[model samples]
Target: MRGAFSTNKTMGEAPEMFYVNGFAKVVPEVQPNHVNNVDDSSTWYEEIIDDDLKWSFKLNSVLHKAISEYQDIALLDTKRFGKALMLDGKMQSSEADEFIYHECLIHPSLLCHSNPKTVFIMGGGEGSAAREALKHKSMEKVVMCDIDKEVVDFCRKYLVANKEAFADKKLDLVINCAKAELEKRKEKFDIIVGDLADPLEDGPCYQLYTKSFYEKVVKPKLTENGIFVTQAGPAGIFSHKEVFTSIHNTIKQVFKYVVAYGTHVPSFADSWGWVMASDQPILIDAVEMDKRIEERIKGKLLYLDGAWFHSSTIMNKAVSKSLKNETHVYTEDNARFIPGHGIACRP
Candidate 1:
């Protein structure tokens, strides 16, 4: 809830010097006579949430920083969240709460399907999505396609939790744009996951969220009983309409049964939304969902369980009404990008 660092001057005082830390470098906001007035306690990382708002945290330490072809990347350790990953100045994942995100993203759709033997993950460069998918005893093959090899390599080297999943025999990792990769393949998947970056106006990921891509490319590549799921951005009471409602409405255009759900992610500072769709009706109740979790999954899910999953689907009145009334169908020209997203792509 901290305000963004300011350089504006006071009425009679000298120019202000604000220092926001990045990759261990404490660059000072230098002005007349204020160049040397850097405060050591001001070493924090800040993310813009809106024109008038920002979020920041005190940095314990910074591990890495670099600019890749697709985006800028950083790794930092914090007292509150453990190790954290940053891309394009936006928080991607935090060690303390990442399990909540990864489990929720991969488990629901996979468990809903009767037998999900083959799975495809788009842009799970961190290997967390593949890790959760592989835990299902029914999985035979899991393909993870990410456009940026650098991100994948960085994750492989540093994300110690997913190392075993990356080395597993069933995983087929590919470095390519997900859309182009899916188009080239003749094989189909039982579950397809969009574990992608938020759709930013400057990001290349906006097209991947469009109706054209879903119907023309993604829908045709799924098996008859297949399910498609994607993270649908922020679902806070004041923020759900940015992408979540429109994403649900757009998918309803192509699928027979579609459901939008959400859960609070502490690190994200909002309730994150997800949309799941399939041709087959989802008939299982919470009790049945729990039974499947016992029989199918290898380890206990830290964040999601049958009861929690059921509750997540029951949206608040405001979001429910917005979803019902939404008319937007995502297209290249008409797409909506998250306003708070960091510039994650060149185009």
Candidate 2:
């Protein structure tokens, strides 16, 4: 491995009586309830944006830290952000405001489809994506396939907010590489979500973002009008050039209609991007979208309704121009990755 890569929100629960792949024997569980604020080896953490820039956060304690077969994991109690989950040194989501990121990543594509019944999530191990998808009355099945069982179980045990979601019968949690799981299945879905981690050098997640995979594996698994959506890394004025523009361009190569939207996520400490694409027309009428949200989904949305949906798609001038001019197509050999990992503080 080149180094540990950061992800947005691929975390989840351990299954009962389910065959967990690669587990010859079950591992012992540590109760998350026992994690205390006074015990820790670090008081702060850093998110490296690049060589010259970074973001920092203060924490009450290091709740849990470990190295799984796939990556480094940390569960933290932050001073202000409630509880935070970090993978490979990068914080994924915070308890205080993860709803913002999850809502934006999921709702637009589901609402865009006339009635999205079946959905496939590539890597939302945290169960937040599944939690959001199950709220839709039209949803029949939501399959979540993540490559790592360690992180999934970790999230399931500690992320108490998503407890009900992980237990929901609608979610079919599969322990396998998304590519392998997706390709093996004969069925197609109304929406296929790339609730995946940001691409990093030598990391296993980048191939799913490539043009060839969209044209080959992903597109074929979707229904005729199926929509494919993915998290497109950083999209701020300073960071848009990194992976967002390139991911957008790659999806554009395979789909006729592509829309890129962004929102500033506080825990991420930067603006984030998500790209939604489909071979069919993705209508953007705020009124229609609002109507669908009201009809198809249960409960009130904390963020992302028709009016906000309309505005979020309107990318900034620099990012708009950058998307139009970006030439990079994400490929296995030629891909751009978000350039930072989390680092524990030193005293």
Candidate 3:
């Protein structure tokens, strides 16, 4: 399912329309009125997370821009975060702190498993998730599935940090809807990572976060002692409370044990939340976990270690109470995730 790259469209033009699999669709054009307009006076890219909260980065240059079938993709060279990737106006990853998000999202679950070999990554088109998974010497194969081929191609071309990952022969790139692809595949993995975008109401990822997707599509694909982990949402008590708790509670319904954790990602401007769930115990002794990580993972890690692993699992009282009180389960019928709005810090 490879998408053809078009350098034909010019800036400020109505976006071109293309057909995929018999359906006619128009690639979303970046409106001149949107943030990061790249006018003569401004070179700043702004990401509006909620109505009031937005983060702005000074752009060095525009690396690539595309309106894919799934979402609008932009790769920008920023003064602070280096090369940054954005999907539909949301910041996905940045060079300066990407290791924090990718390392936290990947290593925790992989280290929790006794021996994680085969890995399946969903929606991590940037290649960092697959890169981290391959860090383990025991990793035999990694399958990274993303819905939009253009995102993967763009990242591979402009994001130098993940270049080795894209070139790794052991990696298998699949461009398709992850849920549909996983359902058809007969092979199961030791670690299943959901490195998807925030599930907004009209977003492509809303269905992926639903209880039905986890129960019917994801669970059966895991090995007996396998672990499932995903990026939950912003961990601020005042922001995105329902999004975090709903993911936790929904996964709790399927797995015997579930734990929610948080870590500060500078580019995101908040302590981001992540959830790990497995029928088997996930909280291993800190000492033993450290030993396994040292022995298995070969490269220098940026943000995660044994002590951080134990501390990350421990949540504040307010967060714990919120999870305890949250009774809603996210199903396909009731899946409406509205991203937090309200200005936090002005650029």
Candidate 4:
């Protein structure tokens, strides 16, 4: 463990300095063989969701942490969530509840379309998106593009739940900027899912969420009846309201119809929001949508079914009002980057 020192200054005489040594008074001082030691005293991985709220998990062991070419990548073996992935200090996914997020993001868009063949996923390096997309028998091809190759490699080795997703024959793994590649390709996709990280200013995802990116790059790649959806961040009334509203409003700029929906993911500790947009109508009738899932989508699903499809799509009243009042549209020139909360190591 690393140690820190503090000094007390005297009035006129020479100032006195003192070294606190070890973890600090608040954290228990227990040295382990490895940096990520799992014992009575373990380190924590914490992420701030907003100014006042933060979520943390006890890390049994830190598998890897490296400065990838584009961003910082971290893989941790956690007590509650199992193996977890953190990109640039933000929680990307955890073993426990990743299905809720991946399923909600991919399925709603794909099932809404009559027959989605080709799919493009952005920033879901863990391969869960591709795995969920493949469950649709109509899906012929899935192109998973992520800016950081290291994150994908780490997840492939350590993330147990969806590791096989990386090896599926239909998945084309591309380690590059997604928007740039999609712009160059003439082929169009029936479903485009943006499973990207929060739009921090210096991060690679900031520009992808802007109005111009969707209008110029993403819109061109979508088929006439295609659907586009992206993770819109925390949707709780007291959480990151601005981020959720901005994402919804921005997508509305390009598509003829847009809908914002929220679902609770236990690992995320909030009702996370996602936005789906399309020129064609999205199925809101729960029964009809459920029938389509049963006929078209294969395999057993954990969270998404008939009842879930109906309940999860309904927006909270406060969230609806927040969207009405929020006028800020995220553009490249006027993007605001929100910093994550601090992480603390506990005894």
Q: In terms of TM-score, which candidate is strongest?
A: 1
Q: Per-residue alpha-carbon lDDT of model 4 for 29-132, expressed as tens digits?
A: 33445353333444666555556765667767789877666766778788898888787667778888888898889998988898899999998998889999
lDDT of 1: 0.84
User: Per-residue lDDT for 1-347 in model 2, tens only?
Assistant: 11423322223432111111101112223347565344333345555667787555666767777766666677878887988877765667899999999999999999999889999999998889999999999999999998879879988988898999999898999999999999999999999999887886545587889998999999999999999999989889999999999999999999999999999998887899999999899966999888888888899999888989889888888889999999999878887877643222111
TM-score of 2: 0.86
- Per-residue lDDT tens digits for candidate 1, residues 127-154, read 9999999999999999999988888897
Model 3 agreement with the true structure over 245-297: per-residue lDDT tens digits: 88989999999999898888888877888999998998888898788888999
User: For model 1, what is the error of residue 52's alpha carbon versus the real structure, in angstroms, after optimal superposition?
Assistant: 1.5
Query: lDDT value for candidate 4?
Result: 0.78
Full-model lDDT for every candidate: 0.84, 0.82, 0.82, 0.78
Is candidate 1 or 2 superior in TM-score?
Answer: 1
Tell me how candidate 2 scores on lDDT.
0.82
- Single out the weakest 10-residue window by summed lDDT for candidate 4: 17-26
Best lDDT goes to which candidate? 1
Off by over 4 Å in 2: 1-42, 341-347
Which clashing pairs does model 3 show?
50-341, 51-341, 51-342, 52-342, 52-343, 53-342, 53-343
- Compared to the true structure, candidate 4 yields what TM-score? 0.86
TM-score per candidate: 0.89, 0.86, 0.85, 0.86
Ranking by TM-score: 1, 4, 2, 3
List all candidate RMSDs to the true structure: 4.7, 10.5, 9.3, 7.0
